[model samples]
Target chain A: MDDLNLLRDLGRALDREPPATLVRQRSRLAQARPRRRRPGPLVIAAAALATAALVLVPALLRQSGKAPATHRPGTVKAVNLLLVGADGVRGDARADSIVLVHLPADRRRVTVVSLPRDVEAPAACPGATTGGRLSGTIPNRSLTCVTRNVEALTHVRVDHVAILAYAGLVEMVDAVGGVEVMLPRAVDDPASGLKLSAGRHLVRGRPALAYARARHGLGDGSDLDRVKRQQALMAALAKAAREKITNPVTLARLVNAVTSGMVADRALTPAFLKELATSLERTDPATARYKIAPVVPDPRDPARLVLDEKRAEALFRTLR
Target chain B: MTAPPAVPETASDADLIRRSHDDPEAFAALFDRYAPMLYRYVARRLGPDPAEDLVGDTFLAAFGRRDRYDLDRADARPWLFGIVTKLVARHHRDEAARYRALRRTPAGAVHDDPADAVAAAVTAAAVRPRLAGALEALPRRDRDVLLLVAWADLNYAETAEALGIPVGTVRSRLNRARRKVRAALGDTDPTREEA
Candidate 1:
């Protein structure tokens, strides 16, 4: 037999049919596609805060027909905005990251809490059973289901909901010329194609997204480590936003990028965002606290996590 | 306005890809069509364990770059193959190990199918080890060109498009690879009639 034909025969010998259908892959693809129909909220409440700090001031002033004025403390109420980084098409999307942004009644501090996606939580939605990973609730139920669960767990009301797709996250990061991330050790994660040496690096949109998404080949290979990275990325984004606010051109680009990237609840109107932004202006990036909800491995499934009741209550009480 | 006609089953890959730009769900049709063949091709190189994930990754990567696709090209096979090829390169070690393992496997060990005629099976079994050893010895690029043609059945033009190389380069690489394979098989020029 000719060598080419022999090679063909060898290929046939090695051929195998995949064990199962491509359902998992199909769903993954579905999740990766950016949702186009819904215009939701931005990824980082910090992005909104920064955008509001510079971009919205003039717009708000024009609407109110008032001279330049600062937002006084005690005028605005404490707000809890649920920022969800989700994947998949609308309605069936999965919440990969869930962060609660709390602005105190005094607006002196901004406390952003990262809730690990694998934590077990009760389902507060009607006709839904209790006890599943918080992230799973979004796919099985609606985004409202996830919000209700968060409220039930923390005893805090969710005033606004914003979902950011990965695509939007990329755009917002690039809009501000990229965010600086500090890695203690060099990372070369093949899965996500995130290659960065140890130390500080200013990563553009795609690499920033990869850094946030990569879990393996990093610390402990746990989901909590990824949560920490996400928090760090958000803080860096806020810092970048603060730095870029001085440049009107970059500020305009950021406003356009941030607004287009997110899908927000109707309640989170332009006026409301402006108010939130103005209130956050006094907040210092150094004083902004990032916390992960207290968690312990679930007794039933060690791989999953259950909130440590006492510590979680303490954490939630602080947010309240 | 009247509702647009449903996408026909016979819709070209480029048509589906264009539709997916507007409706992301439309990309699933492309997945359903090409995934099986793509899976088999990857499985042939990397074994079954990584095949499923790799194929899935290929489709996901393709979906992300769907807008950049040359809509003028009616067939997405070459494009899909190109994505899979790059992914396979990332796992080059696994592929080389697979080939080395095949070289060690005994003749007729894999071709034990009852449907195969005894004589043809013997011929295939004899050549399998030598072919695998030759493949393992070839440089990664030349092997890529050779396998895309011999295994994937992509013609010279399609192979060039898939690899992002010129047609002449594809010809030269394939020729060099075939010469090595023939030498590895001892140049017996066995008079077995071409299938």
Candidate 2:
């Protein structure tokens, strides 16, 4: 390999080995033949400290991205796009997945909000096709059902929204690598082709998607329960992406894999995608906080849950 | 002179050095592996020119103290690093000045990439003026931890050992340093946002 390009890049700083100075010093020390002394408390403490240090130090470094290189900062204010995806048989492109992310310029902090797909919400400005007469009416559906509705009503200015169908989700999950989800309860959904035991399973691609999608065998058999599971999986995906998206080759692969079958608003052009990708380069998962919108289990309808607006507002206030 | 047989049982770097006190070559191999990392750490803190001298001084000091060295550990990297940290401590003025300089220059201005010349210059123009004062305001210990971790890539444990503190202490110091840096840098995300 041509060493220059590899050596000069920021990653090289991570991989560089020390030079000859140490070797020369070591030899000098070896020849001097220092006398060995009996074990003492100081020596013992030093040894203990070293042992304690060895195990703890490496793991902490692993928490952040490998190492930051000298790259120019992005030339704009922090931009956040709340990505949401949902399943809607009869709606004007409701985003089923919700990811509220704040991208800062320094690459220091990223805040993400993952919305439950089954959250019941009112539509802000219902489009003509949703079969609604009320221009600003609440829909009798999950939060995922009213994502675009909420965005429009609130004038939250969603930069982009993407919707992925079940099969597409499976393919995307498979492409980047599988996602890990912990089953709080046993789940067996014949229709979704999911049969998971109550343990930690590394489900990739299609099976993993099924696991994320399965609600029949989970908590209270509610879609909100499944949404919680989906959020957990996304946290894992973000971490994996932090490590995986380091190289340009892998980055291109990811962009191709995700963008090809993905659906987004027309404003999410190629230039916007580049800007977003560049913006996200430094969002390590270690520092980011993840939370779901607060919702109370409906007392009227036991199977459904309603958004706890008061607590949710408090949480959103902190985010703002 | 011929060296002793390589014994699997005599396993630490310190042990190897102890056993091979008669063989200078074996000891040299261990030194070679760690010197540059220490040098870079010191240089980043102290600057390139004097860093060379301090690095040389650190190794020489290590050589003088090797007789007192315990051979239990196979790697001398951490021990050598500790010595360099102490050496840097003796020249606190230079270290402080370096941080001050770093704060003045925009992070982009430090780029080694030729292609980024224009962008870096523009970035430096935008952010460099405000950063220096903010950096100057940070407590010395906090600045030390931030620079070492960000520039030197010392893991928290290694930083602790080098700084002669507990691991928890290192983490807290780092957190404080980062908070100050973020605040000074205007709470902007460096990767995607412009200054």
Q: Which of the numbered candidates is closest to the native, going by highest DockQ?
A: 1
Error of 2 at B34 (Å): 72
State the lDDT at B16 in candidate 1. Answer: 96
How much does candidate 2 score in TM-score? 0.40
Please write out the lDDT profile of model 1 over residues A1-320, one tens digit for every residue.
Answer: 57787778777767676655445566567668765464234233334643442334434344456554475656778988888887633555667899998878766677889999888877644443334778752553246888887998889888887776666778778988999998889987655657789999999998898789888677887899999999898888877776666677876777667666666666766667666766655556556789999999989899889899899999999877
Evaluate model 1 with DockQ and give the value: 0.33
Error of 2 at A204 (Å): 2.2
Model 1 segments more than 4 A misplaced: A1-35, A39-73, A88-91, A124-131, A137-142, B1-195
Query: Quick one: best lDDT, which candidate?
Result: 1
Where in model 2 is the C-alpha error above 4 Å?
Answer: A1-75, A87-95, A104-107, A124-148, A152-157, A242-253, A297-305, B1-195
Q: What interface RMSD does each of the candidate structures achieve?
A: 6.5, 15.8
Candidate 1's error at B20, in angstroms? 7.6
Error of 2 at A25 (Å): 70
Looking at the true structure's interface, with contacts defined as alpha carbon pairs within 8 Å between chains A and B, what fraction does model 2 recover? 0.10
lDDT for model 2 comes to 0.52
